[model samples]
Target chain A: MTPPSRFDEPWQAQLFALTVAMSEAGHFTWARWAEAFGATLKAMGTDRLLDGGADYYAAWLTTLEGLLDRSGHAPVDEAAATKAAWERAYLATPHGQPVQLPG
Target chain B: MRRPFGRCILDSGFGAPHDAPMPHDHPDHPHSLLPSDPALRVKALETILVRKGLVDPAAMDEILDTYERKVGPHLGAKVVARAWSDPAFRDRLLADATAAIAELGISGRQGEHVVAVENTPDTHNMVVCTLCSCYPWPLLGIPPAWYKSDAYRARAVREPRKVLAEFGVSLPDGQKVRVWDSTAEVRYLVVPMRPEGSEGLDEAALSDLVSRDSMIGTGLAGASK
Candidate 1:
């Protein structure tokens, strides 16, 4: 099906596509992804009920990060540092213009 | 958009009962990968994946940009416009969307089983996937985050009018609303009612006025945006 353009936002679509691309390339198996994601959902636990409207893609990312940690695959602190840089870029970038990571 | 995680999130951090313990070790604030903004967060993830060689940055840009800038509602718009101009094609679409769409040479994932619902003056249709984010990816590309959200999935069914209204799709009280929930196996595509004065326009021209949300029944086609 055409993914619907129904993604609540652009990030959701981007992330969804990213996961598919990574999986297709055999970087991670669907089973591995499901386990990690399922664990993350379980972590949300009883509180998942309280966080009434959590974004799935967000949870998916958390699962990916957590899985990477388990597998020892991330570029030591690269994910953390990239996130920080994005936060900084978002702050620096003006509204309506796309944010770019600076060199 | 943040409905608290009940007691899971303490006044301080995760699993902190009494004093809101903020561990601050890349603490997961929300929105999965944090960074708050979706675009920025996506960028961050993309950067890391590229560095790891799991994803080629150039190809990654192309894949994302294809859906973001290139592919979109326009493709669906053409299908819609052709249906408007040709009743036979519309009938084929309604009867066997896959075959009809295939007639136009459009085929891909997420649209393996497409069910086209036409919007008439008396009735309107909308699409959703309450179970999961099962969208007609081949026709619409990527779905919006709201389409995948828990709130939208619930509200789209329970209070469709309210949901449509929020989407700026206020319908007449007389028109009955039919909501279609897309599944992994079957996908629903809404063929919106064509606007008047669009009569003289060709299929391509008619396609120009079609927006992405219109196919999902959240917006109207041919209306000035």
Candidate 2:
């Protein structure tokens, strides 16, 4: 999803851009994420699983991607691309890196 | 980067550049032997401590247990303390972070080009490592377990407002939330603004206003009621 036009801040725009890219790349599917996370948690033990709850499942997708990269399933070039996009946005900011606005 | 345990001791403290033998037997010792995995290294050290009867194994374990939590916040507190005391330095930091941090003599292998991002009234910034966990080691010591976790990486970019809510930070409906993903080439740190009540406070008191979460952009600087 392209982030809402209301994202006035530079960092917000960058994050919106990144999320859109990753989602388009099929990395943000909730179904695939839930399945993989459920299996991993089953192996980690029940008590540990209980502690993790929903947040654990969310983190698992990121872990799955890393594991895919490590195992050569995901291309290293993709990561490089994401890094490049972030750098471009970061350099434009006054702080010289992308940062979040405080409430 | 691989050095014998003995050589690591000597080199870590005081040793001539050419005095120690080459870290690797080969002509080019490209990779250091130290395990990159923090848990494995801790385990290896724990075994040595146990064999030597240096306190009980449980005592060493306890140290490792607490050691992980203490290191990051301690380093963060120091950075915030320095920033609060020096406005010129803080300006320099906002301009060219790597050099500004080096001014405090806190640069090394892991913190080559550390950048500091400031959050202001108009903007909010958050950081993530979508690929691998790249962090500012000199200022923050090490990335936390949650930081390295995959869920945080994905959700942070996808639904940052939701994630921040988990940390008890919520932006207004119209406010924008920006997230930066760090890599080996470029690393980032959040420089939260000085709080309102901190006007007359000294460096130490001001530093108390900064928290690890604030530096991560997951929390706000301390606000006096």
User: What would the TM-scores of all predictions be?
Assistant: 0.60, 0.49
Worst 10 residues of 1 chain B by lDDT: B1-10
- Give the per-residue lDDT of model 1 (tens digit) for B42-130: 55667777667877645544555566555666778889999999999999999999889898877753224888999999989999876
Q: Which stretches of candidate 2 lie over 4 Å from their true place?
A: A1-103, B1-71, B223-225
Q: Write the per-residue lDDT of candidate 2 for residues B190-221, one digit (tens) a residue.
A: 87767776787877777778887788888887
**lDDT scores in order:** 0.67, 0.52
Q: Candidate 1: what's its TM-score on chain B? A: 0.70
DockQ of predicted model 2:
0.02
Q: In model 1, where do residues sit more than 4 Å from their true spots?
A: A1-14, A23-56, A63-103, B1-62
Candidate 1 TM-score versus the reference? 0.60
Q: Write the per-residue lDDT of candidate 2 for residues A1-103, one digit (tens) a residue.
A: 2222222222222222222233334445423433444455445433342233333333443445444455444434554443343333323323312121121
